[model samples]
Target: MAGTLHFHPNNLFAPCITNLFWFKLHHHVMVQFKKYVESFPVKPLFIVFTVLFFITPSAIASVQISRTQILMGDVPVTLVVKTAKKHTIKVTRAMEETFLLGKKLSDSLSEFSSASDISRINRSPSHVWISLKEPLSLFLLEKSVKASNLTEGAFDITFSSSNKHTSWADLAIDKHHQRVMKKAAGLKLGVSGIAKGLIVELMSHHLTKKGFDRNLVNAGGDVYASGTWIVGIRNPFSPEQKPLTKIKVKNKSVSTSGLYQRGSHIIDPHTHQALGKKEAPLWASVTTIGNEGPMTDALTTGFFLLPFHKIESIVQQNTGFKVILITLKKQVIKISH
Candidate 1:
């Protein structure tokens, strides 16, 4: 991304300060005296000075520059910054590197550490317990499992090729020792859901440290914004659908869960069945905004299973978050901060 800034020196500082310290000091006094003179000024001198001050620096100091792309998360990511071009580029590069490393760490721990990988680790049960090479992924998985339990199993990480029951909670994380153990055989872990958010958070922190005033990190659909950004909540029912509304977001995360994508991927853990039928009016899509991505992910999943009345309570409990639920009938309900 590239941008330009036109700086008018007259708007910022006096024009005659371009030379030596003493000359600049004399220029400041003269400008102050000129301002006082202008208060009772002859019109011609006032007009001439004003035009010189305003136009000169604008022509001299206007800047134009381009920003380079920085790859982040599991893919390449780029964001536009309107201020501090050089610093923004450096920050973006650092964040990109951080996100790439974080993804590598997450992939090593979970993606390659599946049941198939475990089968190759060893053939013995007594020594089956293993310590992950990367512990942050393990921490993210722990948080996901806890969220799953809290949301009454609406958000689950477990899936089986044979269509059987496998719970992530059954796996134990020894945080002190940085190890994990499975209670039963055939239990596997996948960190796909929560890893994106972790990567976004990491990048956001990196950019903030580098003094970029505003930035956004979007991993597929999961997004984190450091400063003000506009979001469009999609309308679920329309064939020619548009975003139901525009929302202002800052330093927050937004996640949208819907039946439109990967139909029935989310199953209610308690019943071990997809959410198909319900007693109350349900939305086709639900978009949730919150301080953390994992929480937003969990809440969006849970909200899909809840009645409209229940959603109010959920929003109330998590006060800082906002929610927009788009029904199958094309109706929109907004819960705002």
Candidate 2:
């Protein structure tokens, strides 16, 4: 029997076949095959057919994630999550809870805040008990102290006389008892270096648990990514200049340190003074990326204190870490694996 074929622009199968005989045969077979197709279970078979029909060897779905911002650690933090479809409700709730938890943790650890729990600890040694959900924040403090020691106290966190001679490691954590102990009287613990990074990490973990496989959490300049993300390192000297370098990273962190944003915040711990404003004509901003956001954050400050040659040597000693230094004269230096 003679049969006719019809093509629809919106239909994916319309463009490939040109032979009228094959097209007529296909049309006739499909027209008569309705009962056979309908015999299969509806939902599951429909899904399978839809998937197979769409897999025409060239069709692709470019799924994009959504981003939201929340205030945490005295700064606006942006969280990005990628899923099959929009999940604003879940994202908003997750972010709200994350920020609340972060704020509570920050309140417990901040040394600068007058009413912080750590401040109360500074006043009296009565065994201040602090609870934190973010373990990386505590870990960062320990690592920062060690980094400070390695740099000969260049990055000391105990600069304040009120919190003198303090070590985060000295503050023992009784996980079984859910309490932290500090022996020294005036010793205070602060998570300034790690708080923002910890917030990003925690938020990423939370989103991943919610089925978000690709996402980025950025707290100011500290950024953490679970999948490929784009990051730009600003040029410290050139206010109008574009980023010194752009990087694509996954499951990693990137941080930049310069005299621009928080000028005197990164003080030389040993000198107890501001890092000299003497700008290096060869490089103004130094950005570093590594396994941990807090480490990248701390190392950026440490690298700013060292000379160009020393920066290369230090980066070489540490594998899997990339560094980009931009000088005042617009020179760019990159060290990466």
Clashes of each: 0, 5
CA shift of 171, model 2, Å: 8.6
Q: Each candidate: what lDDT? A: 0.62, 0.63
lDDT of 2 at 77: 74
Judge candidate 1 against the unseen true structure and give its global Cα lDDT, from 0 to 1. Answer: 0.62
Please tell me which predicted candidate would have the highest lDDT against the true structure: 2
| Model 1, position 239: C-alpha lDDT score | 25
TM-score of each: 0.67, 0.69
lDDT of 1 at 60: 49
lDDT of 1 at 246: 75
